[model samples]
Target: MDSLSARSSPPPAATSPFSNPKPVELLKKVIFAWVQETGLPASICVRVHGKSFDLHRSPLISRSGYFKKALRASNAVELHQEFPGGPEAFEMAALFAYGSRLPLDPFNVAALRCAAELLEMTEDHGSGNLCEAADLYLNQVVLQSWDDTLIVLQTCHTLLPMAEELLIVSRCVESLAFMACMEILDPEQKRGRPVLPLRTFSDRPWDPEAVKELAGHDLWIKDLIALPFNFFARIIRSLRRQGMKEKYVSPVVVFYANKWVLSKKTHKFWEQEDGADHAANTNDKVSAILQAIVELLPIRSQDPDRNAEIVPVTFYFALLSMALSLNLSDGIRVNLQHCVACLLHLARVDDFLLPENRVLEDVSFSRELKTMEEIVTIRVAFKSAENAEVVAKLWDLYLCRVAGDPKLGTDRFMQLIHTVPVADRETHDHLYKAINAYLSAHPRLCNEDKARLCSSISCQKLSQEACIQAVLDELMPLRLIIQALFVQQLHTQRALKDCSESFRYMQCGVFSGSIPSSTCQLPKSQSPYDPEETTPVPLEDHLVQRSEHSEVEYESTRFRMQALEQELASLKHSLRRRNPFGQVSDCIGSLRWSSQRKYTNRMLKVFRRMSMLGKSKSKIKQRASASGSLACRSKSLNEMYDC
Candidate 1:
């Protein structure tokens, strides 16, 4: 136990004058030389003093058998609040050994454990001024015992939830400063001489049952906010060294980052009880983090592949930027905004280097995208009770009535529209378009999506059926716009008497409850073209609704058209075959006569039925019409006709 007593031999491999060896070897040498009969070296004594000093503060005996057992894999427990430091120190040594990628030398094995202990003390334990402490021992730390590092890392695993809080607070700078030391000074988790800060949040799909799972592993908020800067530094250094020259490697990295980015995109910064605390991140702190992300963004961006197979891969840097700087303090929101703006810029960098991809490109995504997007989604709306009220505000900017007028003010929509730069228009359009395209081209957002985007609905009773009722909610605005346009265009035409046949058709189609020809311009083509768009197209298909996932739109439109055409053809055939005269007049006359008396009777029956429908439409109308003149009669006549 004496500082001057040498107990163990230095393990196998020696540092070659040639290639770089591991840090654990050095650690072993330190331990072998330090526990000597003579006086300890200045550096060796200093390093041991720090790791051992905590022993005095903590009650655990340094030489306890329990502590020794923790050094081995036979027992590992870092998740609990009370993991022993001696065992924890052993875990660190093991991790450092693996990471340093050197042969295990028993003499420096203690050094590796010392490194792990240093990192845990700073990152998880608030052990000391982690950077200064780790830096003091960095010269003596081992780098070979990385597997051992995992053992140590496994002990610090519960840091995930704490990382979540740090992310939310937008204390990303502090988070980076916190982890930066861990990455470098620790010599275990740290690799490649990374000087910049780095925080990693990894949650694999599976975990030991009844133990811990990554599925629900919420990251420390600080880590989340610091993710942008930390991830960027980590990725740039780690990936650049790993050879981004590998064709798909960059893409994969991009994919993971994109998931985190989009997930943060949807997070409502204001949702937390302490949400306001993070408001500070809105300022310069966020800006600095954003600047870091921008500095690391990749240069050439393109997915030349047809499928856009790993499309999200392109978003890695952006995702990291997003994940970081997430914990925006009230002061940091500006910084977060600036960071977001930079991310948006990064996402849109290439603008256009190739023909736009229009097909429903499909790729199997890891949960990263879903996870980040969920964060983005949740943040966008439900971050606070206040956010819930403002969510429908999207209608103010995006929803349009009849492809022309937005129900929300035009100025408002235009304001929002202007916010999207021309360079990003295509990507933003492609994203939503691609989603709808995927859904429409493949399946609806779900199986019930069939019920969502059919583009055509069969009019059953045309009454208030749930589906029908929903349709009216959507189409009534459309109808209002159509009616407005009809009225506007009519001024240029003539009166009802002088209007052309086309005018009558338009009017009748609308009033008679027949689906109107798509105001979106119907195409003359009878057959589906393989080059057909996935989204609904106008007359010539110049990317009409490509912004809505061209694939899905195309599929929906194609299906609806096919169905409608078949029905129209059958009706025509029946008319022609039955009449022999190639006339609809005979059929029309018979139908008219059969319906005249019955239609009038049905009108009365409907009025009686409405009494049970919980409405007083008739009474209201009657009350108003009681004093009317020609208008009243005409109104009554129209109602009768509808019956």
Candidate 2:
């Protein structure tokens, strides 16, 4: 044969039924046409939905008819002979889609969901396309279905291609989409739901009614509800997984039953027992979140991006829900937000804040921090593929609440701060710039409009402790309080520590700024003496004779301390003992209530005293060190390297 002819001649073809001899026939027989003709499964979903909607007209076998049509049309049965998870899935999906919707027939939903899941493991060389179509249908109706929210969440025995797809898509969600859908869920719309500022995520100047109409849609309340679903799912899942259903279920159930106590609709019922009601609300909120994390997302090595973006999204919603449902403060909000930041870091696939992004280490703190530079350069509009505030919030919350516990007090105060690769100079510098700008402008977070102010600033976690301590530098007053409440609230039922590193909000309550004197609630109702600012107790030298005879001389102040400690010990004992009422008041009282106001004050006093002592010691040390020659300073500077 001629070389050209030999080259043109096709190589020995593989043994197959349709090795086309004609080019024209090959085009017609190609898989493209088959795919085009089969089309997407979206139509199948709409058709099934329509048929199912006609209650009296639709037959039980309508789904089978559609499945049969799909099978015949696509030759899916033949395809499944070589594909994966195909034919049986086609049948089960139809049933699940319809079953999940009809509230009266959950068994059908259960049957369909499980049956379809069996096809997942069939491994019958099912067509990826067919399986994908089936998965997409199920995920849209089932995973995101509000009607069968609990069922879909609790019965997470299998992972379909669609759920994986959803997870993938969720990793790239935009803030606009989150805000668009989330704002619609007014916790106030339903009693016991969270009542947060759904409109704006920013503390600067967000309008509570920015997208009021949009927030009121059914699309906003998804099956894996960001708030409602998460809270319940967290509680149920964790308890069930831990096999502690009976142990903690009753108290939580009672708290839930007293939902009436939470509803502002029945505010009068709790008016006299606000503290008790608040405590109950707080504990229930915790239980709800525990149920969600433990139950909703099964224990799987989730995609880093998905975990980074989606985990924190769910958590922020949980935090928001806890804040609204139970009214938390800035201290709690800081802690929760901090915890979120830690989880996000754990979930990140890449150092989102990279060396290129790190302006500080790149050049040292040359009049600017590195991380801040990146922030300034990074565009953070409502939309951006590169944007990840949900992730950032998670990290920020971590730094604030769990990272550095100053009370470990010494070297550890900077542990978390250092453990987290300090934000590069750019980011740090950028933060400084923002801070300076804010301070220069005398920036105010609250608005004159009552609802606007309430919506914009969450006072729940923005207590003096959170701010002055500088734990939550990114958090504002309102956001901080809400964050803190979630921590305090969630901890009562289930510790955030039990959650995986990717989900736990560890340093969530770290506050920024100084803990002002007014941070404590002054007892307006029972102040027997004026609040003391400075100075120590006066020694009555002239009363030496009286002290020699009167054992009751130190009565009042000593009595106050004993009374406070007794009250606190009793409260802790109650919490340890599990109060008969089952409220978490005991936990609250232990954390906040003390008889010796002076004793608590003294702890603050000790901090101040230590501050003075350290300053004096440092001054003396500095003077003594100065005794070194100026030439030594030059050598030390050379070793340090120039900034």
Candidate 3:
């Protein structure tokens, strides 16, 4: 009897090797043991995507409204509908129904939430159901943390209709938009800890500090790029609706495009693969995405103070290239072209050299050419000479690169060349180079075609080196070479005539004593007409002498004018003092004042002409120096021609 009592008397209060198990732990163990039991077959068979799961009906029906409703009809149940989160998520739900711990994290949280919703796990079914628990975890933890939110959002892609039906996608997108705006709009708000008194979305002035903060902390942008394009577009639209500045929003678009749309591997695959339904479907999806991105761009922002370029010119070119490849709508193409033309001055030469799409090679090239034409037309309409010149240089280099393509025809090439006005370019060196490239590439072209190509090149605008090169080029027609030589001779003659006139003016000035002899002296040995013997004067010396002489003359004339003014003032004072109410003094004072005004006006005109003449002489001197070099080069070319 004592031994029996010892075995049953709580073992003399001795501790077991393990501590006492908590109630929750014990419950988990019992539920897991029951689930693992093979002694009794599962009460229900749940089918998901051809896979079946044997689950007990008691725990499932108790915890899930969906299970309870389905199991009411029979003991054995077969699910014929699609399941959110797949079998793994369904298993997790089943384990939770059996009083097992449901592990909630960013990776599985989104799927579990959708699955719980589909299974109708809610407060009505149980006190703390999977749906409510998931909602708590997502709102309190996942959505609050930026990185976790991105992770969960990525998982939502697989659980579509239900995820959308449950507003998980919308919640994630709105959270992202809110956080992004908070980051850029009010940087003082710390991450993961949202504060109150949120800034309202109004038309506020540009904030440089916020932009700086955004530039420094762009990790959010990197996190967002991995999200599917649909979610990304929603976030961008949310940002826009929240009145986020374009400067803050555009970079996100660019980074996303760089990853998904502009990747060479992806673009090449899209271009090369054909005749497959999957490929066609993918093309359609990508086209829609691209169109959405284009529409989301801030190209239409009409804020007058928003002067900065929100979208880069290069990215616009990229979009245009993709648009051409996909054969997007005319409206989209036209809008893109307009944006590009408006910002054409900001484009680089490489921007125009779009990657060739071999599938639509001709169509793409022609469309690109049309874009160029549109840019030129818009720029020329503005009548901004500076922008015109920039466009001209860009087109010239672009033409040089494309001229080597064997398929580029003369008509198309000439059409591109004529897009820029002839007067826009100050020098045709780049144009000549482009034309030479074309001629070299198409060696079999007839003389008429060559002349037509060369006709756009103005001989007068060609630099000295370009002129020499043109004269020596064997591809050049005889008529062009002769025209080039004749133009050079005419330039030389004009320069010599100007120089002779300047010398004669200087000599006359010195003889008339208008200019000091020492400053205006000309060398007796130098004759401007004799080009062979004439030596070019250093421009710096002439400028220095002219400046010094002008200063001296101005100072002397100023001194005389000041003395005359003082004398006039004294005479007027004496006339007022000596002849009070005397009409004669008044008449004399008025006459003197009129004469002084006329004399000052005449002197001002004379000084203006002198300054003008000095400027003209300097310009003539520059022309003369340039013409001397051209004359030497021309002589060599002439001798070569004779040979």
Q: What is the model-wide C-alpha lDDT for candidate 2?
A: 0.31
Tell me the spans in candidate 2 whose CA falls farther than 4 Å from its real position: 1-216, 219-282, 285-294, 297-301, 307-413, 422-643
Cα-based lDDT at residue 371, candidate 2: 32
lDDT at residue 277 of model 2 (Cα atoms): 72
Task: Put down candidate 2 lDDT per residue, 1-643, tens digits, no spaces.
Answer: 1121113322232222112334223322332343365653222222221222111112122333334444445432222232212322323343333332222121123333333333342223233322344344444554343333333333332323443344422311222123323333334344232222221232222122332332333332221232333234344344444443232222232222223222333344444456757657545645444333332332232343443332332333333334433445544444434433334434332222322233333323221223322222232321333334443343343333321221222223233233323222213322222222332233332222212222322223333343222222322232232233332222211211122121111112112222233532224542323347354322233123323333243233234324433443443343344444654321122232353233234333432332333233322221121112222432343233221
Q: Give lDDT tens digits, candidate 3, residues 336-366.
A: 7777777777677767734466455652266
lDDT of each: 0.30, 0.31, 0.64
TM-score of each: 0.25, 0.21, 0.63
What TM-score would you give candidate 3 relative to the actual structure? 0.63
lDDT of 2 at 498: 27
Order by TM-score, highest first: 3, 1, 2
lDDT score, residue 578, model 1?
A: 37
lDDT of 1 by residue, 1-643 (tens): 1111121321233222113244335545544444363353222111221243111111121222233344345222243333223333343343332222234332333333333343343333333322234333322332223222212222222333333332311222233233333333344433342121111111111111211222122122112222334443553454345333323223333333333333333233423423665544343443454445434444233322311222222333333334343533333333333332222212322210111121332112222222333323433432333322222222112222111221222233233333322222222222222222333334212323323332222222122232222222222222221222222222212221222233334434434556344632334553224356675433233322222243343344234324433443343344234343444422122334444344324323332332222242222221121122322332443343221
Lowest summed lDDT window (length 10), candidate 1: 198-207
Error of 2 at 47 (Å): 51
Q: After superposition, how far is residue 275 of candidate 3 from its true place, in Å?
A: 14
Off by over 4 Å in 1: 1-247, 251-308, 311-397, 400-410, 414-643
RMSD of each: 23.1, 30.2, 22.3
